[model samples]
Target: MQNNKRRLVRHELNASIDVWDAQSDEHLGRLANIHAQGLMLLSDAPLVEERLYSLRLTLPQSLVGAGELTLAVDCLWVKSSEDESRHWAGCHIIDISDQGLAVVELLISRLR
Candidate 1:
């Protein structure tokens, strides 16, 4: 059963885009889907629920005119994939700059 409680629709990317931990610069995971208010990540490990994270999204320069965007996000939930080889995390964007938001909007539009 799938939960359909999200307010904003998320767009899945065809290309690979990596998400990283901004402070540690560690490669956290790949962006599974994204929207203006939130994003989902596919990682090797599960993220702690209800914890805040500073993440860096690396985007193609041609798509956003910039290389990366930093965001503060709160992990809402996490679940292990059925195969148990990966984890999916749902996170809500808590903070972002106006420019970063613009880039996100643009990316969503292009994805659509």
Candidate 2:
């Protein structure tokens, strides 16, 4: 069996939080789950693995008193669903502001 090397536990998000391309403002996907280090995105198209992406997450105003959070992420992997209707991409958080990290932590807490 392959050992899991992940140090952080991922939390599946209940709400539909849209993920966007920060540069182009294109809709990339919805956040499926998140952790302190990374997140999983459910998208209509597969993201290129090993590529770095600037993502913007639209957070609920009531949750963190913020409209959006931007993050620099490195795409780790991408997989298609069984029915091939959607794609899921795993990404590593490469860069984020202190405030962004704080918001992410708060979001994880609220998820639990």
Mark the regions of model 1 whose C-alpha exceeds 4 Å error after superposition. Answer: none
Quote model 1's TM-score: 0.93
Give one digit per residue, the lDDT tens place, for model 1 in 1-112.
9869988889987768899999989899999999989999999978899999999999987897689999999999999989989999999999999999998888787755
Error of 2 at 39 (Å): 0.5
**Model 2: residues with Cα > 4 Å off, grouped in runs:** 1-3
RMSD of 1: 1.2
lDDT of each: 0.91, 0.92
Residue-wise C-alpha lDDT for candidate 2, range 12-79, written one tens digit per residue:
97788999999989999999999879999999989999999999999988898889999999999898
Candidate 1 lDDT for residue 2 = 85
